[model samples]
Target: MNLKLQQYINGKWVEANSGNTRTIINPFNQEVIASVPEGDESDAKAAIAAAREAFDNGEWASTPATERGAIVRKIAEFIERDKEELAHLESLDTGKTVEESRGDMDDIAGVFRYFAELADKDGGELIDSPVPNSISKVVREPVGVCGQITPWNYPLLQASWKLAPALATGNTLIIKPSEITPLTHIKVFELMEEAGVPAGVANLVLGAGDTIGAELSSNTDVDLISFTGGIVTGKKIMQAASVNVKKLALELGGKNPNVIFADADFDIAVDQALNGVFFHAGQICSAGTRLIVEESIHDKFVNALVERVKKFKLGSGFNEDTQMGPLISAEHLAKVEKYVEAGVQEGATVAVGGKRPEDPELQKGFFYLPTIFTDCTTDMSVVQDEGFGPIITVEKFRTEEEAVNLSNDSIYGLAGGVFTNDIAKAERCAAKMRMGTVWINEFNLYFPHAPWGGYKQSGIGRELGKLGMEEYTETKHIFQNLKPETLNWF
Candidate 1:
């Protein structure tokens, strides 16, 4: 589908109030793929006002849960119908391989479907009377207008995590996707409209984070704010949310650990380690960028990982054989390069790749090689900070206790992995790890049925599963007098 990129606000596609546009580039070829309206604070306020009006006056909030679920299911159907087009656009926007983009499309559809089926499963709950002839019950209600901010890495997938639950709960929301990757998001909004969503129920604003994001968090009309991005932005959003004391849900980046013990299946561990960080060029928030290995087999594991990294096919996303694509942009490529340089300066060995590939066809694109840093210490910046790029840091531990200590020594606790043949040890490590999600003998695997979030400074609240739908709702207690006269104490 050809896209004339514009913001979707009040159920209509419109230009930004700033009259400015930002060019969206295809990272694989350094070509301009599309241009979208560059919205500002004014545009954000306009969208928020529309959502407020809709929740307060429109039929959306009063709609039955079953009907809302049906609408959400219809939207999922539309996503399935346009899966190929959406996948192509996502790959072009984010510089991920076509296969990965197609997988994301499938997961995105599943998210909407999951929430749709869950909508009518329960309607709050009933409670017993505490006093004679009196009854009390707890019920869940929509949280009114929500302000949602999604990142660029998994544009539509992350948006689905927020959009589906908010809509299913009968709340009006305005979403501001990252300025660089807004194509798929805009397309999904079109689908929502076609699926019979009411006017102003789902709004989209396109712009930079400083303006659009700030307005969404600070707007008094917005009852909740959901953000997924870097730690700095998440902190700012939290402060901004204080303006109205709005509910906040954040999913920030992490320096996740992939722990491999001496007893682990070496071959599978190496493969899973590569899959965790190299996919999407290691831009994922929960990428296992840190590899904490048992000292007994650290050398062997690092050598095997380096060998595999050398054979990884890197090229344009359109190439069917390409295993990895370019970095998201020139700025991101530079950032990754800087991180590699820092690793070397901090006394870490550049075990595999430390520079960009020399292929002439890849020269024009923002490409970075799969990099590995061995002999890494916990004190090193590369091991401590989230590069958000295609780089992995290898750290060695003498004992299981040391490995657990090393994994939990970070400010991030988003996700982690434990690879060991011993199921008991895996379970023990999973329990000790401070992360929100831990994979035993696996890495980077997720489902719609499980909750995803982080501990410590990683972020606040959870997304997905039944807990996700609850994030968009508020609790209320209703009391009634079954057969009583007025209270004389009044």
Candidate 2:
């Protein structure tokens, strides 16, 4: 059965004002899964107005922190109850394996629960007054209405990172999920309403970035804009937000690197290296697509990686045996193909699995085999840019210094890793790595309790942990005068 999705604005499920809609296709089978409203500037304006009114009228902004936390916790409860359905919807929406989609659901629930627990624990700060007749204190308050734009890669997961913190901090929000993958996010809005979120406190607008997203960034009523997507869009959002001097939190792309040393445990490193790039078909922004190997083991490591890449199972997301699902869309599939073609033209060797799987059953879907390009240099397009697919580039480095230099050569500094047993060497490399999050032995292991973000062109601020909550708050100093005296000089 095909589902019809609508925008949620001012606590009501509604259709687009223009009566236009976009069909959502399942990347797994290229079939129509749902259709959502094609929102535009008018819908964004309505959502912005609703959020502003809710914040200005204290509908959510004036709620007691503990009460707000309780409401957020209730949302988490609803998520837990509907996790299975949500997981299936997410799998169908983005063409990820059900297992991975279930894992995203678990993480999403945990994010909400984490913010709920943290909401009331912080009570700002009190400072001793230097002035004899005054008391001074610092307090945190909501940043008013927040406009959030999430990506298609991990629709609801990225939205949770923005929505949970914004709501927990007593702020009203207007969220725009990716036009291509709004199903899971639409389901989440139902959960939020069921949790008793007040009318106009949270609104959803399903639309393209040019209209809804641009309006969100340029709207004066929105006190903050949090966006998660590619670098180009992130820069555009920043430029638009600058007009109003709104607070901005952006998480952009990364051409991350994974460094393997000669002294590293060969078998474990090989396993983790594969885990780094092949998960989610390497669509992750922080996936270690650039592999820096010690010259001594470069040949051996490339051989092992190629063998493993050749064996990856690709099929429909619903299939239990499918280790990796198709790319998000036909356009993304074409882009990945172009990158592989460029890699070959630039003199990189295709070690294994460099083209589409020759299976008739998978032809309808946007499927690409796990690809590895060996004998690569840092200047190669495949190594320098983010492919955002199941592709890896192997480069050889003799020393740790060279490895650090090679890893830091790119404009991105989102994430990197080192695989070695020597504690001191690992520490040195980790310290030298310019990325936001570095792993010594493991790859792609993240927790909700730790801060997640990047350096340089990667992003402007952090998300997750206590810092995530801080992104949605503003600081103000309150002063109390114990005694008032007229100025004699006047």
Candidate 3:
């Protein structure tokens, strides 16, 4: 089937600014699945203008919050009704398993529903005033226009995380999705139209990060800039937003650690560790790529992990037996391979899969074998940086203090996971970890009602919670006189 594509700006489907086009290749098959309108700076300007006008003058911002929420909920309904088609498009466009894409679809729908449910629930709170016969209250107002930049891993889901809350709170948005996987977002724009989001309220612009992304970050008309991607690009976005000092929310890269205590449930730890890094082909930002296992049980844990890793089926995302899909692109696959090579040369041991699948059918794809390396050191690049793929380098820790130190050693503090049966130990681990989100026994799980962001270089601000909606809002204090005036300091 031939795929149809267009850029959504001013709530209309339009061609690229210069009619330049690019073929979006499916990483799983290395096939040109679709042709997308290659956009640039001019398209970026058009989108920002539409969203700015809508927020500044259109009825969208002035509409009741409850009604605005109803529109978001309608978008959720559209997502549910079109899950199969969107999931397929996502798999084709992003090289994810159909199963993974379907899960992402559910996440997208849930995000919209959660934010929609919160639409009309807010009201002003009364407080005592310092002055004689006076009352005061506080109000939350939308922060004009928002510029949302999403990464390639979770296209539709990440977009919903930003778009739903911003819209639910009556803020218009301009979305710049990763150019590599723009198909799902195009589909999302269609659903927004079906949900009756007014023209100029939500707009989609496609282009390289250097051209359009920079403009979105620095656009004086944009009030908030929310982004999710790498630390390098996050830094670039930060520099751009500094031009206007716009409210910034970033969910950047993570070298999250998965701690396995000696007395803990080793089986569960192994499985969660695998899920943490291998899921999404390990393209996630918060992947538990650093496995900090305590000694005395490291050998047994590694053996069990190898057996489980071997049983994982490698194939197309369309197949039910495939446990993990390909990486996002060939360039990413090569980077992962180079990391594995470094792990070997730096004295780490590969305990399981390290090379790509040998099957000819999989040869054409950007596939990489899920790799597990033991005896990994803290200084090694594989252990230090974000692998951003299906590779884990295991390192052993002795004392509790050492474990904490090792986990917190990295520049990134996005997320960390501690697997322990003892409540005290888990709580202590949670307290010591410097990350924004500390998973007691879970990994890579998020809800729209919880704030999602990272500490340190992992990025700033938050997303996906009550706090997330507030990211696009500004608080205003109001004072009123209830009685005749009183004398104050002259």
The C-alpha lDDT values of all candidates are 0.93, 0.91, 0.88
The sequence of per-residue lDDT tens digits that candidate 3 reaches over residues 281-314 is 8899888999999998999999988999888877
The deviation in Å at residue 216 for candidate 1 is: 0.4
Residues 211-288, candidate 2, lDDT per residue (tens digit)?
A: 999999999999999999999999999999999899999999899999999999999999999999887788898899
Tens digit of per-residue lDDT, candidate 1, span 1-490: 4775899999889999879999999998889999899999999999999999999995897899999999999999999999999999999999999899999988999999999999988676778877788878898889999999999999999999999999999999999999999999989988998999998999999999999999998889999999999999899999999988999999988999999999998899999999999998999998999999998998899989989999999998878999999999999899889989988999999998899999998998899989999989999999999999999999999888999999999999999999999999999989999999999999999989999999999999999999988999999999998888877895
| Clashing pairs for predicted structure model 1, backbone only | none
Candidate 1 has an lDDT of 0.93
Compute the lDDT of residue 246 as modeled in candidate 3. 91
Question: What ranking of all candidate models by TM-score puts the best one first?
Answer: 1, 2, 3
Can you give the lDDT of residue 410 in candidate 3?
Answer: 93
- Lowest summed lDDT over 10 consecutive residues: which window, candidate 2? 1-10
CA deviation > 4 Å runs, candidate 2: 1-4
After superposition, candidate 1 runs with Cα above 4 Å error: 486-490
